[model samples]
Target chain A: MEGPPEIEKREFGVGEYGRKIARRHLSFEDERKLNEFLRTEAPFYISYSVGYFKFPSATPMENKVLLGSDLVFEFDADEVGLLSERDVWMCDSCGEAGFGYRLKCPKCGSSVRIEIFPDPEREEKLKEMVDALVKDFLLGDFGFGREDVSVNFSGNRGYHIHVRSEAVYELDKSARIELVEYVTGQAIEPQYMFGGVVPCGKDTPFLCVEGPSPSSAGWPGRMARSVLNALERGDRDLLLRAGLKRKDVDALLANRERYTGLIGRGRWPAPKMFPLEVWANIARLTAPLSGHAIDTQTSADIHRLIRLPDTIHGTTGLVARRVKDLSSFNPYRDAVALPSKEVTVRVRIAPEFELGKRTFGPFRDEILQLPLYVAYYLIGRGVAEWSLDSTE
Target chain B: MEVFYEVPFLAVLEKRKDLLPENPSNPPESVLKAASTHLRSILYGKSRPKPVHPSVFFTEANLVAFSPSSFLWERFARHYALLAVPAFERREEILLRHYPPSEVLSLKEFLSVQRPFPELKLYHLEVSGGKVYLGRRAPLFQASLLYRDILRWISERVRNIVVSGSLDDLRETAQRVLAPPSGRKRGYPHIQRLLNVTGLPDGRKRVLFYWLIPYWVTVEGKTPEEVLELANEWISRQGGAKIYSSWILSEAENVRSKGIKPWSVRKVEQIDPELVKLLRGMGAL
Candidate 1:
C-alpha cells in the first residue's frame, strides 16, 4: 500500500562557507564596511544580560563572537531576536570569555556567578544624598576627594558609592562606621540612642540637649534655677506644698517623655506651686558621672554624648541650636505619632508620583528610610507602585 | 525496497515510542545488534543495495532521548530538509542551465538572505548553486546545504563499498561455510519475511525520521551511555569514519565518569578543558 518515496541529493560544489559574522573575527576590510554601515544607523538603548557585574557602560563589541544562526551576538539592541539563537551580553566581564550568566567561567573554566545589575531608584536617591552631602560637607569628612568617588546602580535598587580614596581605603572598620554615620546623619551602631538638648537660656547647650537626665546636671540658669529651686526645699512635704505632685516629681526624675515635653516646652503650669519638688527632680536627673550617668536626668546635660570621640550617640547634637523645643521634635515619640494623631494631615500628603517606569515618595522621607516601617506604610497606604532599594 | 528492514528502524522506533526495545540486560548487549550484520557491512566498506530499512530510521527510543535545543536545530538544518527532497523531480532548467529561477528563489527564501538582519544582508552572497557556496566566509550557506553534504557522503561511501563488493562475496562465502552439516537444514524456513500491509506505509518514513531525530535528541531523555551508544551506532551504520566514532565513544566515557559532560550546559564543579576544545572543533559548543 506504500507509495514510492523520493530521495534527492544536495551537494555544495565548493567554497560556500565563507561568510564570517562575529565582530571579533572581522578583518580590517570588514571593519571598514561595518563601521560605515553603523555610522548611518541610529543607536537605540542596549540591554544585555550579565549574571554578576554590569557591563562597562558600553558594549565591547570588538571582543564579541557569534555562533552563527545558533546565536546572534551583537551590540544589544542592534538585533531583535526572532531567530532561535541569540544571547545578549550585558556585562563584558561575564560573557563567553569570562563567567557567563550560566555560571561557568569560559577562560579558567570555573563555576562562578557574578552580581551585576543596576538599581534605578536607589541609585537616584543615593546619588542625590551623596551629592548633597559632598556639596555641603565636602569629601574631607570621609577623607576622600571627589575624583576618588564613583557611583554604580546596583541593578535593582539603591546605588553603591565606592570611594576609592586612599585615606578612606586604609581606615579601620570602626572609623569607617563612624564616618558613615556622620555623613548620613543617622544613629551609629553598638548604641541605638538619639541626641537632643533641653531648652534652657538662649546661650545654653542644656537648652537643647536631652538624653539620660539633663535636669539634674547643673544645667544652666533660668532652666536650672526653676529646676534647682524645686530641689532645695528641705522636705518632700514642703516641696509638695509649694507645687508639683510627688508623682509628677517622680516622672520628671525618671526623665519620662511627658515630663521632658512639659519642661522642654516651658509649659510647666505649676512651676511656682511646687518649686522645691520640681528643682529636686531636675537636680537628680541631670547629674553626669565618669563617662556614664550617675544621676538620672543630670547626665543628659551634655549636648552631645558618645563612648568615642566624634561618635555622638543621642539626638542632642544633630538638632539646630535654635530649635528650643526638644520635647515635640523628638522623632521617636512625636514625628511617628503625628500621622495617627493628625489623620487629616496624613490624608492630605498621601498623594504619590510615577516617574520613568518607577513610583515613589507618597510618604514622608523619614518613613521611606525605616526598614519595616516603610513596608508597613506602603502596604497600609495601598501603595504597590514602589519598592524598597536597600544598600546593604 | 530492501531498506524496510535495516535502515528504517530508527524512524519507526521514534514514531512508536511504546515499541522501543528496552535496554538489554547489561553492557555489550547492544540494541544496535538488531542491525549488526548491516552495520558490519557498512563499517567494513561494503556497498549495500536499497536497504531493508532506511539508513537512519525513526525509533520510539529516540523520542525519549534528550538533546540541547540548539543542537537539535543544527541537526534539522544539517539533515532533515535536504534528505527529504524528491529525487526524480528535477527541473530541466536547473539541471542543464544550473541557474534556475525557482532554485534561486528557494535558496533566497531558505537562507533569508533578503531579511532585515544587518549581518545577513551585508555578508551573504547568492550565486545560483556553485563552488563558492561552501567556503570559510559563508558558514550559513554551508550549514543550509548540509543535506547535500550528507547525501554526498552517503552516496560516495556506498559507491566505495559497492566497488569493493566484499559484503556480497562475504555472504556467499559465509553461506557455503556456515551451511548446516546435515541436509535436514534445507527443510528449515528459508524465506526472508516480507512486509505486512496491515501497518504504517514506508512513504511516510522521511517525514517521520525528521520529527523523530529532534525529538530523540532534545526531548527523549537518555543517560549519557545510551545516547552515545545510539549516536555511535547511527553514525557507523551511515558509514561514518572511525575517528568520529572513537571520539564519541571516548567522550561518552568521560561524561560518565566525571558527570561534567562536554558540550553540556549542566553545572558542575569541574569540567575538562579538552572536552570543550573538542566540542568547539566539531562546532557543537
Candidate 2:
C-alpha cells in the first residue's frame, strides 16, 4: 500500500459513475484494480517490458510444458544463436503465451506490425532510480561533483537517465552498459550492446481509449456487406426482406457515432483501422458521396474505402496543417503579375520545384503575361512530361 | 463576354482591373461553355487563325491552346459546386467588395493565406474562366506572370514527382520553354508544344500550350495517334490549319516506340468500379 505522492492527483467518476483516478504514479491497489479490469474486459491485450534479445526465452515453453497442455508452439528465431538479441516485439494479440516469435497474431490473425517503445510511468520510476545511482557513481566512485542528469520516461516503458556531464558522452560501450545495467534491473555482457547503447526512448503515448464495441461500430462487417450486395444488385427491398429492424440499424448508427466521436477527439494515433489522419481523410473523401448525412451504411463504406497515403511523406506535415491558423494570406498568390516581353528569357528559379523556394524572374520585361491556368499547366506538364534531371 | 472569343478567356479575365458589378446573371453555364468551346477550339487549333508557316502560326496565334472546360468539369467543377465556391461564396460580398490590387499584396503575404483557403482560391484562379478579383487590377503582363507561376505550381503539385530524373521529356520541354532565346524563330510546333516556350504574344497561347502538354504527354498517353488526333482537332477549324505539320504525328510515333508514355493517356474501353477501386488503392486519386 503506497500513500499518495507528494504531487497533486485527480480522481473522477467516469462512465456510469465508475470511479477512476490519475496521478504521477499508480498505487499498488490501483495497479491491481486497473490491471485486472483491463485483463478481463479489454478486447486487446496489454504488454509490459520490451527489448531485443539474442535468443528466444525458453521459459515460456518450459512453463507451458510444466502445465502439460498443447498450448505452446515453437518456431525458430530469426537467427539461431543468441537469437533473441534482436529487434523488440510487443504483443497485443490474444494467444497462448509462448517462447516462439510470431509476425502474424495467433488469435484474431491480425498483422503484428507495431510501433513499440519503453513504458512511460515505469520508465519514469526507473529514471528516478537511475538519477540516484548516477549521483552516487559521480560522488562516491568518480570523485566528481554531482551534475544535473536529465531523465526521460520512455512513452512506452522503462526510463533513461541522461547524464549530461562531459565524462558520460565519452564513455565506452562497456562502461556505458555497465552504468545502465547498474541503474536498470538487468545484466548483460558488453558484447550484447557492442554497437553502443544508443539512448532511445518511446517519445509518444501508447494507451488507447476504447472506441464503440464491435457490434455498434457500423452495422458489423457482415450487415454492411448485405447492404452493399443489395445496393449493387438492386435489392432495395433487402432491408425489409432480411427482417432487420430499424431499431437494429439505429443501434448500429448510434454505435458509429460513439466510435467517430471518440476518434474525432484526436486521441489514438495509429489505431487498427482508424489512424486519425487516415480516418479524417476517409471521411472527407467519402463525405460528399455519403450525401449530407453520415449514416451507418455510409460510415461502413467510409471505413472500408479510406486508405493511408501511398507515400510516407505524403502527409508528413498533415497534422501541422490541421493545427495551423487558416486565416492567413497566401504568398504564392501575392507573387502574381503579367510577365512582360522585356523579360522574354523566363528563368524558372528551380522550375522543377526541386528548389525549396521559388523565385520567378529577373525578366527585363521579356516575360509573357501567362495566365494562371497556363502557367500551372506548364509547371505541371513539365514535371509530368519532362525530366529535369534525366537518368537517361 | 463574347469579346473573349478571339482572346484567351483566361488572358482577358486575368487583366480584370475592376471587380465587375455583382451581376448574379453572369457566369452562366452556357456562357462558360461557349467561352470554353471557343477557347478550346483556338488552343487545339480547331479554329485556326490564317494561312501561315508553322513558325508564323506559333508567333501570330493569340490564343494558347486546349479547352480547360473538360478539365474543369472532370477535376474540380463538382468540388467547387459542392465545397469550395459555396464555402467561400458565403463571404462573396466581402471578397468582391474588399478585392485589393495585386500591388497591395506581396508573394509571402499571399502564400500566407494558404492556411484558410487551403489552395481553394488558388485552384479557383487556376480553373476560373471568369474574372478573378485579385485585390486591385495589375498590368496584364504582371498578372500574366502570376498565371504562369500558378500553372507551374498546379502542375508540380498535381504530378507529385519524387525523383528529379523521373520527369518525362514532354514535361521537360514544357519547363524549358519558360524563356525563349534571342534568336529563337517563332511557330515551331514542337517548341510551341513545350509549355514554357511561347513565341505567341497572347498569354492564352502559353495556357493552351501547357494544357496540351498534359493531355498529350500524361493523360492521353504518348501515342502519336492520340497526339495527332488532338492536334488535328485543334487545327481543324483554324485558318492556319495548313500550318500544323506532320511534326506532332511524327513525334508521337517516335515517343510511342520508346514505350515511355504516361499510363493516364491510354484509351480504356471499360473503366469498371474494380478498376476505380484499384486506382484508389494505389492512391492515384
Candidate 3:
C-alpha cells in the first residue's frame, strides 16, 4: 500500500438517519471495516473523497496532510443535454399515460408525474463524453498515456474517468484550478492561445498574421483542428453558430476545397478577405467542442466526495462497474451481477428500467414476476416489495 | 474596524467601470447586476474573482470580501484610486482629495492588479474639480517613438529575428527616437543587466517597475521628479514600455511611499505571480 489509505468520512452522508457524525480520522484498516460496513449497514449511498492524505484516517478535513489525489472527471447523461425518450409519465387522476419528457397529460388535462428510466441513448452519449475525455483531451491534447488513465461506469446515469499519475498527485488547489481552466477552456485569452498580432514589416495596407493549424499544441491545436474539420466537411451550421457573417460563411464554403487544403496542412493563407475576428469567433465557438463538460467545481475540490468504484449503487442495484470496452458496455449487461432466480414483486409505480437484455416495469400497482436482479433494483428504489406469493 | 479585503459593492463598480456614474450618487442597474453576480459567484456558488477575505478573517479560502464600507473611503481613496463611492456617487461622500498627477496615475495600475475586471484601459475617469485623469487606452501611444524603438529592439531579440529587414526598421526607428540628456552618461549597468524583452509587456511589466524604481531612488540620489524623469528616460529606452511611462512614474511613487518592492528570492511570490517567471529568468528576484 502507498502509505496508510486515509479517508475523511466513516459511513456518513444520507446513510445515517437524522444524525451527523463528528470528525473521525480513519486509516487503511478501513478496507476490512469497509467490507464490514457493506455487510452490516447496507448503505444506500456510499461516497469517498477523490484525493489521499498523508496520515491514515485522514479526517477533520482541515488538519490532515494531503499526499496527493487522482484526477477524477465525471460525466452524467442527464447533464450532457441529451433528452431521454425512455422516461415514462402517467396521470394518476385519469390513468392517462405518455412516454418521453412530459409534465402534464394531453388526454385528460391532468398533471403527470414522470418516472425517469435508464436511457441507452443518453448512456451512449455519455460514452462519447468519456471517449472525448480519455482519448481527445487526456491522451491527445494533454499527452497523458493510456497507462495513466482509467474509466468506469458510475453504475447509474454517469461515468467517472480517473487519472492516476505521478504528475497529477502533486498539484495544489491553485494548480488544480488551472488544470480545470485548461480542460474546460474557461476565461482563456484568445490572443494567447493563437498568437494575436504580428509584426509590422514593410508598411502594408491592412493587417496580416500567421494562421493556426491542427499541429499546434494545447488550445490552439484543438481549435485549429476544429476549424479545419469545418473546412473539410464544409459545415455551414458550425460556422454560422460561430457567429460568422453569412457572407464570410458563403465565401469560405465557396472556396472550401482551397481552405481545407491549407488548413488541413495547418497553414492559413492570410488573405485580405478572412480576417482575425472571423477566426477568433470560430475559435471561441469551436473550443468548447474540445472541452469536457464535467462539473467545474468538483475537480478542484480536494475534499469532494466521489462514489466509490465497484460498489453496488443502492438505487440501481448495479455495480459501479469497471468498464473495459466502454463502447459496448451497458449497465444492464455489464454492471449487473446478481442472483438470476425469478421472484415475484408487488410494485407501486415503476418506470421501465433495464434489467439484463430486457427492460421491465411502468408496472403501476400490480404483482409482477421478476428476475431477482430486477426485484433487487425495484426493491432498492422502494417502489416494490416482496410479494406474499414470492418464490425466490 | 479593520477589514480583510473590503471591496464588494465597490468591486462591482470596478467591473462596471465604464458605466460608473460621473457622480457616484447612483450607479445604474447594469452595475448592480454585475455586483450581484460577482458576490454570488463566490458567496453562493463556485465562480471567480475568488473571494479575497480580510486579513482579520481566519477563512483562508477567500470566502469573505474586504468591506469597502468598513474602511474610511476618504483615506482608502487616496491609497487606491478606483473605488465604489459610498451608498451613492456623491462628491462630499468622498472628501475630494486633490492628489498630485503621480497619485492619480497610480489608481488604475493599482486597481488592475486587484479583483473583478483587471483591464488596464478599463476606465479613464477625468474629473475637473479633482483634477485627476485615471486611465486611457495606452499600452502603446504613451510608449510613443524612441521607446517604441526600444520595444522593437527587444521584440526583435525576444523573437530572435536576426537583422536584415526588421533590423533596418529598428535602426531607422531608433535613430529618430534615441536621445539622452548630456554630460555624465554614467551608464545604468544595474538596469542594463536586468533589461529583458524576452516577452511582450503583459502583466509581467510589473517586475520591470518593481526592479527599475528602487535603482532610481536608492542607487542614484534622484528626487521624486528626477526619479520619474529618469524612469521615463531609461525605461523609455527599451521601446516597448512607452505606454507604461506614466505607470512607471506612478509605480515609482508607490515604491517610495509604500515600500513596494522588487521581488526578492526570499519573498517567494509576494506580488504579481506573472513576474516570478521573468524575475527568475533575470536570475535576480
Candidate 4:
C-alpha cells in the first residue's frame, strides 16, 4: 500500500494573511474595530483558532479574545491518522487536494493545507469524549452544574467546552493544576484503584483480582460493570481481546461459576493457580480506557484565554457557535456562519466535502464557481487563489 | 536562718567509658564534667532576658543537692516530676531549709511532696541501681491553635499589664525605650499613646518591649513628623480604632507575599493607623 501523501511546506505570514482575509471578508468597520480593540486590550498572549501570537503586544494587537474563555480539544484527522480513511486536505503551496493524508505538496513539495474538516465517526467520538469530561469530571467530580458549562463547536476538528462559574473563576494556578491532574489521571497509581498485590509462593504463579469495588461510583463503577458484563457474556474471543492468556482463559472458563460468585459478592480473589502475567495484561488494557483523555495544559493554566463563541474561526470560516443542546449539536450544520454569495475562483484542488446540507465536488485544476463561504474558506486556507483574470 | 535558695531541678546523665566504676555508687570525674557541660548548654540554650543560675547545695560529704524552690525548678516542674526512690533507699535524706514542717525527708517523700505544685504532672518514673530518672509530661501545643490564639493572648496580657501599672512608671519607661536613638525623631501621637500606656518592667518587660519593634518602626514611620503625617492621612481615608500594630503588620506582610498589588481598602481598614500610615508612606498603598 502507498504511504501517506506528501504535501508542500511553506510558512504563510500568519498575521498579515489573517489581516488580508479579515479585510476582504469582514466589514470595514469590523476589521478596524477588531484591530483597535486588540491593540488596546493587550492580553498576555493572543492565539487565533489557527496559529497563536506568542507576543501579541510586540507586533501590535492583531488577535481578539473570544467573549469567553475556551477549553479546546482537537481530534485532527492528520494527527489521529485518519487522513487516508475519510477526510481530505489540500496543498497550499502547490494546489493539490485529495481524499488522503498529504504532508507535503505532490507538485512543488510545499506545505499542505489540511482544513480541519469533520468526520461523522471521529466527530461522534470527540463529542463523547467531551461530554464525558463535562458530565463526569467537571460536573460530577468538581461540582459544576449544566448551567456552569457551555459547549461550542471550535469550527474545525474539535469541541470547545467553556466553564463559567464564580466558584472556579478565582481558582489559582496550583488549584487549577490539581483539577487538571484529577481529570487527566496524572500520577494516578494503579495500586490506589486496585489493591496491593497478593503474596503467593515464589515458585507458584498467581493472579490478583483487584479493581474498583462494584458498588463504587464513577470510572471505577463503570469499569467494574464492563468487566462483569464481559465475564457474564463468556465469549472466548472477548476474553482473548481482554488480554487473557490461553491457559488463564481455560482456567477461568473451567471455574466460571466460582469466579462469578466472587465477583457477585464484590470480593476480588487472589488465586495462586491463575497466571499473574495475564492479570497484568488485562490491567494495562483496561487502565488506559478508564482514564479521560483531557487536555491538561488548557485546564491547568489559570490565565489561559479561549476562542470566543459566535465568532468566525479563521481556518474553517465557520462560527465557533455555542451549543445549547450538546447531544443534538452537529458542527457541519450548525457552525456555518458566512453568507452564501456565490464567487468564482481557480480551483487548485477541491475534495468532496459536506457544507451545510450539500456535498461539493472533488474538483481539479479547473476554475469553479462556489458559494462565498466555501470559496472564502479555501482562499483563507491558501489552497485556492482568486482568479485575477476570470470573466463572470 | 531558713533561707530560700534556687537550684537546678534536673541533672544530665553522662556517657560512661568503663562498664564498671571505681566507686560503684558515684559517677566518675569525666562523667561529671560532661554532665556539667551539658547543663551549661541547656542553661545557655534556654536563656531569657533575665538569666537565672542553677542553685546547688553542698553537704559535709560533698554530695550536691538541687533546690526545688528555684525559678529553674518552677520552669522544669512545669512539665516534670521526680520519681520515688525504693524503700531500701529511704534512709538517704534530703534537707529542706524553708519547706514547712520538714527539715529532712526521704527521696520518696520528696517525689510525692513535689506533686502539690500545680505545674508539675505525673509521667513515667524509672529506677535503675541507685540512679532515678523523671519523665516530664505537658500538653502538646497545637500550632494551628497557637496561630489563632497567640495574638489575642498577647494583646490581653499586654492590656492587663498596662492598665494595672502606675501611669508615671509606664510613661517614664516608654520615654526611655520608645525614644528614637540619636538624630532619629520620636513616633506619632497614636504610637506615643500606645507606648505610654504599655508599661515596662524589669528585664522580662524589656524583651516584650523589643518584640514590638517591627510593628513600631513599620507603623510609626521612624520619625515623629512622618508618623503624624501618615497617621492623619490614614485617619482621613478610614476612621481610627484600637489597633494591634503587630497583628496588622503580620497581615500586611501576608497579603504582600501573596503577590497581590495595591492593598485592598478592606485590608487597610483592618490595620491600625500606624501600620496603614507606614505602608502608605512606603508606597505600598
Candidate 5:
C-alpha cells in the first residue's frame, strides 16, 4: 500500500505533535522561506492568510491580527452523523467519551469530538455533499471552472473544497456572505420561486402553485426532481411517510393528471381548498435535501484561518491530500499518510473503525499490536496511549 | 422641536453697517462678500487670489470682492456655512469650498471627525433655548444637526473654527461616508451618531433600530460609569431582554484598534444594559 516514507522514531511530548511540526519545520520569515518549507514538508494541508500573523511568522501569537483569509468550506462526516452507527465521541472537557453519537459531554455539557469509524454509507454521503458543493454551487452558480477549484480530503472526518479563482480572492465579508447565502438558499423566497396562482371553477377556490421548473436551476430543479420522485412512487402512505399530509396526498392523487401536467410544465398547482400550511409542508418535503451544508461562519468570516492543504491532520495522523479528480478520490486510501509499521498501543476506548481495507475492533482498555497508522490515529485522538513496555 | 438661531453674521454685519463701503448693492450680499474677502485676507495674507485655498475659494471673484475681516467672517461662516441655498451664487462657491469633497469621507475619515465630542446632546440649552430646532424635514436633518453641533462644539472646545456645511450636503457627506464603496445607501445622521456612540461600524449600525424618531434617550451622570448604571437599570426594567452586548464590545474593540473614536453612550435607551456594563468594565464608555 502507498503510504508516507518511514522516519526514525523520535520521542515527542504528549499533545505536542503540532508544536513539534511547527518548531522543527515551520520557517515563515519570508515568502521564499515559507514556500520552501511548504514544498519540503509537502504537508497534507496548507493554509495561508495574508496579514493574519501579528509578528508575520510561522509561530504567531494567539492574538495575531487576522485582516482577511481565503474562503474555506468544511464538510465533516461527524457533523452529519456519518459515523453515528459505530463511533466513539470524547469530550475534551470532563474526559467523557464513549461509543455512539454523543453531541455534548454528559458530564460537563461540552461538545464531543467524534472518533469516527469509517462506514461506506457515511463516506459516500460526505463525497456526495462535497461533489454537490463543487459541481452545483461552485461551478454552476459561481461560474468557477474545474481548474479554479481544488478538492481535498480533510484527513479526519470531512472534505474541504477550496476555490482559488482570482474572482473570489478579493471578496469581502459581505460578498462572502452573499456567496454563502446563495449556496445555502438562505434568502430564497419559495413564494417567488414556486408560487403560481391558477383560476379553477368559480365554485372551487383558485389553486396555488408549488414545485420547481425543470429549466430553472439549483433548488428549483432539485425540488422538481423530488416532486417527480414522490409522484413516481404513487403510494399515499409513502408520500405521507415523506411528511406530506393525508389530505394533500389525497388531493394530489385525485388530481394526478392536472398535477402531472403542471409538473411537466415545471410547476404544482394545489387546490385552493387545501390549507396554505399543507402547500408549505409539501413544498418543504419537495425541496432539495441540503447536500451543500457549509459552515456559514467559516464562509462569512473573511478573516478566518483554515487548515492548510497537504498538512497532516494531527487528530487522524492522515494526510489532507489534494484531489485533482473528486469522483474517484477515496479519503481512506488516498489520505493515509502514516507508515504501516505495526505498533503496540493500550487503547482506553475505541469503536469499530476501518483503515485502508481492514477493520479494527471496538476495543476497551486492551493492549493491542496494531498498524502504526491505526495506533497513531488512536493515540492522536487521545483514545489510546503507547504501551509502556513497548515504548521503552 | 423648532429651533431658530439668530443669524450671527447678519447680526454682526448689521451691527457694523458703518464699516461697509457706502452704496453697497445688497445688504446680505455685501455682508457675504465682505465676509468672504475677510476670510481670504486672513487665509492668503492680503495677496490676490491664487489657488492657495481652493477649498475656501472656488472662484477668483470670491477672493477679490469679499473681505469683511476675521471677526465678521467667523460670525458669517458659523451659520451661512450650512445655508441650504446661499443667498448669493458666490456664497455657494465659498460654502462648497469650505467643506471637503463628499467622496473623501470614508468610514475612517467620518469616525475621525466624530472624535472630541464625548457625547452628542440633542438639545443644547444655550444653542436652542431647550426647544428643539427643526431644519428642512428630511431623513437626515436631525443627524445633520448633530453633526453640525459636534463640529461647532469641538471647534469651540479646541479654540479652532472647523468649517460647517448645509443639512443636505452633510447628509450626502454622511451617505458617502457610511455607504460601502459598492453598495451605497441613503445615510441618516441619527443612525450614524448611534453607530459612532455604540462603536459599531457603518455596516452593522445601519441595520439596528429604526432611524425615524431617535430611540436613544439622554441620561445625565457625572461619570460614564454612573451613566451606564442608570442605562443598565432602565434596560433591566424592560423585562429580561438580552441585548447583544458581547458583539457590540467586540465591534468597539475593533473600532478602538483602528484608532477611531472609542465607544461612548450618548443615548441610554438605544444601548443594552449588558453592553453598558461591558463598556464600564473595559473603561470604554
Candidate 6:
C-alpha cells in the first residue's frame, strides 16, 4: 500500500513557492471523468491506482473498492545498481567539469558536488528488467501470453511494466508478492533441486542424488539452463563468478561433454568428480543472475498509485510517457514536455544537465536564457529562480 | 501445496525406477521410447519446444503428466494449523469435522475425477524420523496445485462455500485467505490512510464503504444487493444530509454493464510522507 500521489507543486522564482493542486482521481475507467480530471488538474502531476476498483472515484483503499489489480513492475535507476552519471557540475571559477559529489571544485582544490540523473539512453538494467519480467518470469515460466503484458518507461528514473490479463487482475496481494519473489528469484533456494537429499526407493534405504534436468520447470529448470548456458559457451569467467573455484571451472570445462550430458538427464556425477556442494553452489550463484533489479516493495503493493500514462512526473518535468520501443525511446529527447523556445532564469545552483538536443548549465548563481523545458526542469528541481525585472 | 509440472510420467519414473507400480498403463516400448526421447529433446536439447502438446506428437502414449509433492500447505491453511496438532481422532475424521460437506465447496472435479491437467505421477517422498524415504504404497497424484490452482480454490470457496458467519466473517475470510497477512496493522497505515478522508460529497462520501466491500455472486463476480446494504450502512453512519442508496446501486449497475471497474483512489501527497513517517517513528528525530 502507498500514500496518495503528490498534488502539490513547487515553483521557484525568488524562492520556492507552492501551487495547491487538488488531487483528482482521473482515468477512473470513464473517458469523460478522465478528460475532466485532466482538464482541471492538467498542470499538476497525476498518479493512478494499480488497482481496478469497483468505484474508481471511491479510491482504491479498502478491500471492497479494489476489485482487481494490474501487475506493475518498477525499475528505478537508483535501485538498479547501475552507476550512470547523474549530472556533472563544473567549476565556473576554474572552467573545469566535475564528476562526483564535492563541496568545492577539485580543479580549484575546492569541494564540488555531482547530482545524479538517469541517463535515458544507456540503462541496460531496463533491458534486464524487461527480460526478467516479460521473457523469463511472465511468458517463460508462468505461461502468460504476449498479449497480456505491456512495458513502458516510468518517465522519470526508470521504467514500469504492466501485466494486465484476467489472470493478473485476479491475483491478490499475497499472490502478487509471490510473483515478485519469483521474478526477482528472491525466494529461490538451490537446495531443493541440488543440495538436499530425498529417498530414491522405499524398500532399499539407498540414498540418491541428482540435479534438475536442463529442461526442468520453474527455478530448477531456469537454474540448470543458466548453468548449462555458462558451461555450453565455455564461459570460464561466468562459472568462476558463480562461486566455482578455478580448479572446479577447469574440471567442468575438461569434462564438459560428459557433464552436460549427465546434467541433461537430471544426474550429477559422484562427489569425487566435484564436491556435492558445488552443484548447490552453482544453483545458489546462478539464480541471482536470472534475477533482475525490480523494486520489490513498490511492485508488490496492490494499493499503489502509479504514475498515470502520459502524465508529467514532477521530478524532471518530463511526461511519464509510455515508451513504444524502450531501446529506441530516449527519455531526454522524447519525454521533454515543455516548449523549446529559450526563457530567462536565474540559477542559484545546478549540475550540468542535458535535454533534447541542447546541454544546459553547471550554473552557480548566474543569469542566463535556456530552453523552456530546461527552465521548467531547473525550477521543478528547485535549483533555479525566475526573477521579474523591476522596471515598472 | 500440490506442485505440478508438464514432464512426462515415464520420464519422472525413469529417475525413480524402483517406484514404478506393477501393471503400469504406460504405452508400448516403441511408443514410450519415441515419446520420451522427443520430450527430452524438447527440454534438454537447444531447440525451442514447438507449440504443440506432447499428446499431439505421440497420440498413443499420452505420456504428458503432472506430479504433486504434497498438499500440506493448503491443508495447513484450511485447518488453520489444526492439522499440524495430533489428536485421538484420525486426520481425515478431524478434517471432516472441520470442513463438513455442507460448508465445504465440492471442488472434487479438481481432485482427479476430471482431466484438468495431464496424467498423474504421485510416488512422492516421506520424511519420517528425520530420514528421507518414500511411501510404501504410492498412489497416483493428480492435482498439481500450481499457484493458479490455489487461486482457483480460493475463489471457488469464496463464491460457493456456505458460510453461517456474518458478511464481516465472509469478508474477513476473503481478505485473510486472499491477502494472508500476519494480521499486523503496522504495515497497513496506507490502508488506514486510504480511507482517512471523511465528510465528502454524496458521490464520494461512501469512499470507505466502497473501499471495504467483497463480491459474492458468481456471474460477473459482483452483486448489486450487497452494494446497496453496504452503501446504506455507510449512509446511516454519516451525520450530514442523507445520501440515497439508490444512486450507488444504479451506479454499480452502470459500472457492471459498461465493463469498467469500480472507483479507484488517486494519490494526494506529493512526497512519500510514509517514508518520512517511518523514519520519524524509528526515533531518527
Tens digits of per-residue lDDT for model 5 on B1-285? 011111223334656677654434323665666665554454446333332111121222222112122333333443445442333344434334433222222211222332322121111100111112211111122233244543453345432233356433433433333223221133344334433444332222322222211222111102333423433444354333344555434433333233232222444326655544544454433
Predicted candidate 3 versus true structure: per-residue lDDT over B115-168, tens digit per residue: 211322211222111122332212111212112233444455433333223323
Q: Looking at candidate 1, what is the lDDT of residue A207?
A: 37
Query: Which ranges in model 6 have alpha carbons more than 4 Å from their true place?
Result: A1-29, A87-98, A101-115, A118-121, A194-209, A232-241, A245-247, A270-292, A347-354, A360-366, A387-392, B1-285
Question: What shift in Å separates residue A270 of candidate 4 from its native position after superposition?
Answer: 2.1
Residue runs of model 5 more than 4 Å from their true location after superposition? A1-32, A35-46, A50-69, A90-97, A103-113, A194-212, A235-244, A274-292, B1-285
User: Which TM-score values does chain B get in all models?
Assistant: 0.17, 0.24, 0.26, 0.22, 0.22, 0.28
Clashes of each: 115, 98, 20, 15, 24, 33
* Tens-digit lDDT string for candidate 2 (B171-245): 343334322321233323433333333233222222223334344654345556666675655544232234344
Docking class of 6: incorrect
Displacement of the residue A370 alpha carbon in candidate 2, Å: 78
Candidate 1 docking class: incorrect
iRMSD values, candidates in order? 35.7, 30.9, 18.0, 25.7, 22.5, 12.7
- Candidate models: Cα lDDT each: 0.28, 0.28, 0.54, 0.44, 0.49, 0.50
- Deviation of model 4 at B27, angstroms: 42
> What TM value does chain A in model 5 reach?
0.76
Q: Which segments of candidate 4 are over 4 A away from where they belong?
A: A1-16, A19-84, A89-97, A102-113, A170-181, A184-188, A196-211, A233-244, A253-257, A271-293, B1-285
Q: For candidate 3, lDDT tens digit of each residue in A104-167?
A: 7888888876655677766776677678667766776455668778787886668888777766
lDDT of 2: 0.28
DockQ of 1: 0.00
Query: Could you give candidate 4's per-residue lDDT for residues A273-372 as a string of tens digits?
Result: 5433333334334443233355556665533435545656676777777778878888877888778888788866666667777777676677877887
Return the TM-score for each candidate structure: 0.16, 0.16, 0.52, 0.45, 0.50, 0.51
User: Which prediction has more favorable lDDT, 3 or 5?
Assistant: 3
Model 3 chain A: worst 10 consecutive residues (lDDT sum): A14-23
Candidate 1 lDDT, tens digit per residue, A1-392? 11001101000011111211112111212334333533553111111111111111123432232211100001111111111111112223433321114445556555643321222332233344435434433343222455555432222222223333333322333333333333333221201111223454455444332222223111222234444344443344534543567885565455545444544443333433334333434433322111110121211111111111111112111111111232222222212211222111121122243322334344432323323332333333222223334331
Of 4 and 5, the candidate ranking higher by lDDT: 5
lDDT of 2 by residue, A30-124 (tens): 44554464456431111111111112122332221211100000111121112221122234455222222457666677655322111223223
